[model samples]
Target: MEFMMFCRMLVEISFYYSFAGAAAAHFGGGETVLPALLLSVCYILCELLEKHVTAPSAERLQKAGRGESGGAGRFFRYLGLLPAVFWLLLPGMAPADRICFLFPFAYLAAVIWRKDFTLSRYRQTDVFSTFWKAYGIFALTLTIFGGSALLETTVPAALVTVAGSVLLLRALRHGSEVWRHRDYQLRSLFETGLLIAAAWALSRDAVLELLKTVAAAVWNRLLVPVLTVVIVAFSVVFTWLFQLLRYLLTLGHREPQDIGEILQYFTGQGEALTETVVVSDDGSPVWQIVFFVIGILALVILAAVFFRWLLMRAPGEEHAAEQVEKIDHMPPPEDRKAGGIFRNTPAHRIREHYRSYLRCFERQGGTRLPSDTSRELARKTLELAKGTQEGEETLNMHLGRMREIYLRARYRQEVREEDPAEMKRQTSAVKKFLRSRPG
Candidate 1:
């Protein structure tokens, strides 16, 4: 979870820094390193404090209701925006530049606290919302700063923007699926892939240049020398064989000439012989036109094939309906009880109650399949109980509430104090239905 938060932070920083840097450059200002660094530190600290300190504290204060004024919390929270004043106080800067510098800090504070006035834990969906907001800022910055050099500026920024967008999309897709299925292994693998892709995207030019240099070095220092030696050896052997053949041909005739003299004679002849060929072009070349047409036809065929494949690959309405039907019929596996002695924690008690609820359905001969998720199990069970004496809506409500608690207990790092009681209430409702149902 911490790693996931870190990845989100990285995505935020990449877009924010690019936008801030571009703006600073456009204004002919100095480096934005200080502001960027401060932004990163503040973001991390805010996330940590919210998750660990502020959120839990607020939850306690609300439950206790010790006459604590929520307004005081709000006042202190706005104090987080106080750092922007430091930029305003710095000397040797014009009013415009100071205001410009102040915007990033103020914007950073606003983005940090925008969703809830009080510091609250961010959800996975919140990450996407924050990303789009940051992307909007980047787009606006580029539009304002990239007036004349828009093409040149946009080229590099587009690469980064596209890469960040792809990361967020992949995370959002996989994160939701993994959470639903409790697929931690798949999540880890996805995180690894995202990290690799991000590293490659950021350092693609350096990596390519390094590869090119290594190839050149190998050609110059290793392959070239080896090839040279092999060529030299082959030539020497060839020359010796040629002299030997000449001597054999001579037989009893005048003594065969030395290899050196033979080589000199050939060298002189080679230097003396010279020839040149002249060709003239007439009008247009028919072969060029023929090849061009062939190339165009090949391209057209490839494009057609690609589009056909894309059309075939897309999921249709019928396919989506089939998937839904499959889920409806999917068998859910029996709930696995927690191993070892149970702790008296809210999270543990929630899990225990959820298991008991599942067992109530299991007694009715509805078994769980390993592939079925908690929600899928609940849905399938709901369908099974549709013909029973209890109303479908009531059972669905009970199952939905229990499922929510089970998921939080199973996956969430922290469970609220009220979760165990909620789980017990839902489980009792389910058990009551089971007891009243016709055998």
Candidate 2:
């Protein structure tokens, strides 16, 4: 919507100044052409700001580790203020303004390219809100122009009307939080841009005013009334249904992202979720179906009543209720990386756990305990001895037999699991394996 705002603002400036200036320049109105050129400079400033805010990752990598004490702080500071600065500076330099015309075209190109090239990177929450705001302004500006709506409204008044439409656009998008998909953020940027362009064309003044007048005069003024009635019906139906669903979920130990869905449902845009469950090869959904049915029934009765009771209780009661319900949730911090093979994966976690268990035999300088028949730690070391991505694959296999022997020894307990005699021998083997393997 920022782009839309930029476009609309440009169009209006063009309409009053540039169009007039062009006519003036044609009849030797040298003064008029300057304003046209000057308007282009305003566009240039917006583009420069956009680029300064751009997050091209490869370039960002150099600055990523710089922390807060660096040139980045100055760049961000200038990015926010430069557009307004250049907009004010435009009128004085006619030649510069002509050059600046290329700025908007270049920005449009980059925005398009980024939409394709780094599709995932800019998939962020703020993109769409800004897009819709732009769309609404463009749509309104087009409407006024098409209808030949004589500026019966003052220019500032018209700007206000467009601004309000943008706010409404924001409201609609903001209220849509419940139905978002993983790719929703990325796709919204392209879709909103396209839709706003379409809306601008439709709303251009000539088309809409004609359509508006024809429907109003010929159809007994029916469109508005019909729209109102339909809106009312949708609001009542969806609002209650969505709310009840959210209430039940809260009752059943689930939390929702936002509650505005209750309002959106009435807008004739109810959303539904389709989820999946994994079933074994036995091909029986029977157990899953049984559990779902019981859960739903319990959800309806117990959840609803509890929801009402909780709503009526004191605020602290709700906090206490939440504590009673939650078991062992993690703190919302950067406590763990998302992907790793250690703790959460099968083989790696088991290997690491065994190694930690064996750390008791360590002697010095990263060397493990000496070689012995205490095959437990020895086998684990041997398993890992097969080099990683950095090393060769060829290695001994008889120590592999040690895996089985260790498994048997661990179960039989013929020897104490941690006996020093066996530890000495196993540690030696581990040291030998480590010596032979590429470190």
Candidate 3:
């Protein structure tokens, strides 16, 4: 499976280096160029953002001396502004084109958060809400405003925009279905092929414009990753140096005094071993040039080594490792429980909390179930745990997928099907939905 992805990516990349006007000439290069450019720019930006943001954070990780074990992670961490910034800088990109650019970053960020890639995102309502509100506004504009009578006056663009708008809505509503597949790797490859094919379906003029915009966009994304590799390389070198010094210092010395005397001798200049008191005028720094250089170098080197090996090494390497290890070393992803000090995956539990809202088949008495969207009421038990309104529309979008399942489940007809797997997806939607509601 990995090999397949590798081969597919290689093929996609190779078209660049190949004397491949042959392929382009046949398929009509003029058509696909713009989308190819747009996708290429997005692709580059994604990689670069990961590299750059992760690099400095990774350096901090290493300096804190966090080891490779608890790696600085979160697949789509810098999802918010990077893509938007890329789109804004491209003067030629239309608002519609900008949507295409922004959508993927937002989508990827949600997906990563969903997968529990970084911190368990339960209390992370702020992160989830901010990104989706932007997305929801974009969606609202595309679907509602784009479909308005005045906008529809532009016939061809209206037609294209309307089609894209409808598909985006459908795609988002059933997004988890698309993301969750047994052969997800294969599916992603297939989707890329389809996108590339769609690129070919464009008009020549549109293609050229997209290509230029995409080129600029791709360049923007490249900056981040390039920075990441540089930072990692530097931190690793520093670690190596610090570790080496520790080895040398500890090789023979038995006590702190022994090491300290040796360190002073090694750091001090050979000249002026006499105790004649070098005329201290109440301690203004008289530059004993050789000693000063030696002292400064020793202090810098010692501090660096101490930080890398002592204070930082313990936490950066051993400490962070133990914390992550407890979670990863759990019996299985399924066997793990909801609560543990170091076990941070509350995304599932948060989902379950929200799903309990759905069990109320219309309450009867004073003990009736609370309205799912009632923020004030929900605040009594769950301060921040409220979900989006379980209005028929939201439920229909989330829990109802198949026509048969909807009919059977809706009418209370006896039904025996496997339990739904979308509790997590529902939870994420609830998080996104409630975020729209106030405290």
Candidate 4:
């Protein structure tokens, strides 16, 4: 779970930082980009360290009956967010900027308190709600700051990043089902494309005008409380519809991009597609083409060397052998029969019964190997009989019969005649045998 959370944090930080860096670069009044980037990096490192080291150390201290674990852990989590607070509350920032930063920070504290800092709680929270709330905070921040025209441009872009991040997190979580199976991933692409297309449709100028109108209305104090409620309500409705569109687009109904205008609107690449011809006195595109070719070749060569070096230094024979050995020596997982105990399939029902029998045996201090067959497991029961020789023989006979029936039923897929009476009899015998065993 810690490993999974670490991966999630990495993905979250990467997406968030990329967008934040881009937004800062575009609207930072020519401020250096390094501070924002470094702050993000530092926060990520602190989170990773806390999860990997500090939290586990606290757990060990608690297990050892130490009283300082709680205090130590609280201090760590509090310290971890200091970098974010520092960045958000930097000198000269607006009140709204501080609020925007503090809002998520407050949300984090609430989550930690409510969920006891369980990593999965954060992951399981509604991403759509979280995104828009964060978005609303940023919108308010921009309104309060009123420093840059580029600030409004960031709204749609931030929304796009939110969409992508949420989609990516979902994909990564259920990657085996959604990504390994190509159809779902492809669906995600179309969904993402549709989302970006919608953002493009809400052109920058229009969004700016809307924000300005909202800001003006609020400043004029015209039905201020009612306006706030209406704006929040509208934002919710819009986000829900937008999310619904994303959900529906994944149905593989390829929309018609037939008309040139529709294609242009969807792609929104009209400005990007136009090439600027550099007209110099040289009157030649040849030199320009030569420079581009040289640059491409240089990049390719550098990339090849870097990748080759990376591949060569990758985990080698000893590391791989150690990993294999660890896997081989790992204990069997606990029998979690509840998931399939009431499954509707016959196979699952039979497997659940078998697992229950195994659990009984395991509780009696019996160990089963991965390679052990049903016959071997049954034979092992012969050594458990503590009564007279005749009783041992009788127990072995019952166990042998049970094993035979189980093997045929479990392995023979074509066999449809699994007698419930026989299964119940065998289960009872197994339970009786387990109960007879010495602890």
Tens-place lDDT per residue, model 4, 192-253, is 55754554554445655876899898777877778789999999999899667656664557
Best by lDDT: 1
* lDDT by residue for model 2 (312-406), tens: 21122223323321211111111221232212222222234345435632522244446644454544554556664323222234344334434
Question: For each predicted model, how many residue pairs clash, with residues at least 3 apart or on different chains?
Answer: 5, 23, 12, 0
Runs in model 1 lying further than 4 Å from the true structure: 1-23, 30-41, 67-101, 116-158, 175-439
Candidate 1 residue lDDT tens string, 20-135: 44443444543333443344345555555545555456667878975443655434444434454554577776443453455445555654554221111222233334445655
lDDT of 3: 0.37
**True-vs-predicted CA distance for residue 165, candidate 3, Å:** 13
- Model 2 regions lying over 4 Å from their true place: 1-73, 76-180, 186-191, 202-205, 212-216, 219-439
Q: Order the candidates by lDDT, highest first — what do you get? A: 1, 4, 2, 3
Top of the candidates by TM-score: 1
Q: Cα miss at 130, model 3 (Å)?
A: 17
Q: Which runs of model 4 end up more than 4 angstroms from their true locations?
A: 1-46, 67-70, 112-126, 129-151, 154-157, 173-439
- Candidate 3 wrong stretches, greater than 4 Å: 1-44, 47-87, 91-184, 199-439
Q: Is candidate 1 or candidate 3 better by lDDT?
A: 1
Q: What local distance difference test score does each model get?
A: 0.52, 0.38, 0.37, 0.49
Q: Summing lDDT over every window of 10 consecutive residues in candidate 3, give the lowest-scoring window.
A: 306-315
